[model samples]
Target: GLAERKKVTHVAMESTGVYWKPVYNLLEAEPIEVLVVNAQHIKAVPGRKTDVKDAEWIADLLRHGLLKGSYIPHRAQRELRELVRYRR
Candidate 1:
């Protein structure tokens, strides 16, 4: 994986609806720490609004440990919730 090749220790991404789930699930199995940050928090910071710029901004903040990750339940809990939802 690119992360292993680059020796990346942490990854941070904006939380946008249900889109971050699959990616998070994949990264959860990796050795690196994954942070799902609120988009609003990123927007709150004054910066240029471009995809490239936003990525760099997020990376910079993550590198400095300035970003806060949202609470994500464990895989078992998440799967149980999904099953319940499907049953409902």
Candidate 2:
């Protein structure tokens, strides 16, 4: 993994509603911090429009500490949320 390979300690991701959950779950347990920014904010920035370029744009913004991360509850809290929703 890049985290182990490069001794990376931080990662950034743009939130995409519920879709980001599984990815978040996978990364949360790792020895790295996960940042989830609003997807709309990242998409609003002008840049060389392309699949790869978009990622680069985000990386640049994140690298500069220009992006803000959204709060993500711990796994236990998420599971509790799901349980309550299911019982509703």
lDDT of 1: 0.92
lDDT of each: 0.92, 0.84
- Model 2 per-residue lDDT tens digits across residues 1-88: 6578788787788788788788888888778978989988888866567868877887898889888899888889999999999999
Name the regions of candidate 1 deviating beyond 4 angstroms: none
lDDT of 1 by residue, 1-88 (tens): 7689899899999999999999999999888999999999998767577989999999999989899999999999999999999999
Find the candidate with the highest TM-score and give its number: 1
Worst 10 residues of 2 by lDDT: 45-54
Indicate the worst ten consecutive residues by lDDT in candidate 1.
Answer: 42-51
RMSD in Å for all candidates: 1.4, 1.8
Model 1: per-residue Cα lDDT at residue 32: 93
- TM-scores across all candidates? 0.89, 0.84
